[model samples]
Target: MTDKYSAGVLLFRRGDGGVEVLVGHMGGPYFARKDNGAWSIPKGEYEPELEDARAAASREFHEELGLFVPAGDWIPLGDVRYSSGKGKKNLIVWAVEGDLNPADVVPGTFEMEWPPRSGRMANFPEIDRADWFDLATAHDKLSTGQRPYLDRLNDYLTQTGE
Candidate 1:
C-alpha cells in the first residue's frame, strides 16, 4: 500500500512480424550491462492528486523519449501493484496504437551520485535506447512488474481485433 504512483503509455504497432511495442532500456550503471528485464515502458512517477494518469503518461512519454506521443486511441490496460526496491508501487498504463523510429529518440537524463559513495555526481540518460520488440521479446525485456500490461494489451487487441 505504498503511496507512490507511476503511469506510462505502451505504444504498439502492427508490423510484418506481427505486433510490436516500443520499449526503452533503462540507463545508469545498474542496468548498463543488463539485458533481460532491464527495459521499461516510457514512464515516470507522478502525484495522482495533481494530474490525471493519462496526462502523466503522455508527459512521461515525451520526457523520456523526447518524442511526441503519436495520435491514436488510448486503450486502458489497467494498473498493477508490486513491490520494488523503493517499496510497493502502483503503476497505471495504457496501450496506444502508434509507431516511431527508434533512432529518433533523444532521451532525457538525470544526475545522481555514482560509484556508490565517492561523493561524485554523474549524469545519465533515463533511457539509453529505445526500440520495438515483439510481444515475446518484450516480455523478456520488460521489468517483471510491468509485464502484466503486455498481457492486458494482447487481450485487448485480440478482443477488438486491432
Candidate 2:
C-alpha cells in the first residue's frame, strides 16, 4: 500500500520570552482526556496525486484552525516519516513567523462516528483549542511524530541568525 502523506504549517513567533509556537489540542473523544503529547501542529492528510503539498498545507491550516495563515516566507522544515498502525506516513512542514490571538480561533469541524461502534454521527471541532507555547513547552506539547519540525525550525533560524 502507498504511504499516506500530510502537510502543515508550524506558526511561530519570537517574543521577549523567546520563540513560541501555536499548536492545537486534538479534538474528539480519543484525545479529550489527554494533555501531554496530545497536542499537534494544525494539519490534515492530503492525497499527493491530487494536490500540491504547499497549497495543501495552507488549505489544511485554514480548515483546521479557521484562521487565515499569515503572509510570510515559508521556511521549509522538511519532512519526517513515521509508522501509523500498519502503515507508514510522512509529514511535511514549514515554519512561518507570525503572531495571532489564540482566542480568535474558530476551528472547523469533522463528522465521525462517536463511541466507536454506535450508529450515531457526531460533529466535533477539528481542534478543541489552540494556544501558543514557548519552545520548551511546545517541545513537550507536540506529538512525537511532529516534534522534529521544531528542531528543524531552530536549525533554520540559527543558520540564518534570525
Candidate 3:
C-alpha cells in the first residue's frame, strides 16, 4: 500500500500558570454531530512535490483559520500513526508558539451534497470551531494517536525550559 502523510501544528500559549493548546473541530456532516475526541489539529495531505510538510502545516493553518502565523522557531515533535489504518506513514508534528483568536477564524470551504443522493451542493467550513484547552482536556478531545504530540511538546518544553 502506498504511504500517506499529513502534518499539523500544536500551537500553545502560556496562561493561568500553564500551557493551553489550540485545537480545531472538523467541519462537514460526518463530524458535525461528534464531540469529545473528534477535534484535531489543523492539517492536510500534500504531494511529495510539496517537500516541506512544516510549510504545508503553516499554510493549512492559514487556510483553515484565516490568519497569518509568523514562521517563528518550530520544535519538531516527530510523527505518529493514525488509527484509521489508511497506511499513513505518520503525521509530522510540530510545536509552534503563537496566539490565535478563535473569534477571527474564517475557515476554508468545501463543496458537498447536503442530503445524500439529493445532489444539492452546499459549502461547509473546513473547521467549524476552535478552542484552547489544557493538556488533559486536549487529550480527550484530540484523536487517540495524536495525543502523543501533546506529550512530546510538554517533554520538549520541560527539557528546554521554554
Candidate 4:
C-alpha cells in the first residue's frame, strides 16, 4: 500500500545561548498541556502528485507558521518513515539557516469538534506557540519521530564546519 508523506523546514540559527531550532507546540485538545514529545517542526502532509517534497515543504511552512520561510540554502535531511494511526508517514525535512523570532509566529488555524461528542466545532491555531530552543533542549521537546532531523542538522553543521 502507498503510505502518506509530509514535508517541513527546520529553521535554525546560531545565538549566544547555542545552536537553536524553532519548534512548535501543537494545538487542539489532544496536545494541550502536553510538553515532552508535544513539540514538532512546522509541517504538514502533501501528496506526491500535488507537489515535490521541497515545494511542499515550503508551502507547509507557510501554512502552519503563517509566514513564508526566509530565502536560504536548504540543507536536506532526507526522509524518515514512521507509523501513524492511518499508516506509515514519510517525513521529508530540510535544514535552513535563518532567523525568526518564534514569538512572532502567527500560526494558521483548524476547526474541530472540541467536546468530542459535542455538536459544535471550534477553531484553534495549528500551533498554539512556537519557540526557539537550544539543540539539547529541543531534543527533549521534539516528538520522537522528528528527533532525527536534529541529528542530521548537527552532522551537517559539523561537516560544513559551521
> Highest lDDT, which number?
1
Candidates' C-alpha lDDT:
0.94, 0.91, 0.84, 0.91
Candidate 3 vs. true structure, TM-score: 0.90
lDDT tens readout by residue for model 3, 47-92: 6575689888888778888876655778899988765657655688
Q: Write the per-residue lDDT of candidate 1 for residues 65-119, one digit (tens) a residue.
A: 9999999898999989888888888999998898899999999999999989999
Backbone Cα, N, C clashes tallied per candidate: 0, 0, 0, 0
TM-scores for every candidate against the unseen true structure:
0.97, 0.96, 0.90, 0.95
| Residue-pair clashes, model 1 | 0
Candidate 4: give the clashing pairs.
none
Candidate 2 global TM-score: 0.96
Please provide, for model 4 over 44-66, each residue's C-alpha lDDT reduced to its tens digit, 9 standing for 90 to 100: 99998878999999998998898
Best by TM-score: 1
Residue 111, model 4, lDDT: 98
| Every candidate's CA RMSD | 1.0, 1.1, 1.8, 1.2
TM-score result, candidate 1: 0.97
> Residue by residue across 4-56, what tens digits does model 2's lDDT show?
99999999999898889999999988889999889999888999989999999
Lowest lDDT sum, 10 consecutive residues, model 3, at 81-90
Better of 2 and 4 by TM-score: 2
Badly placed stretches (over 4 Å) of model 3 are 85-89
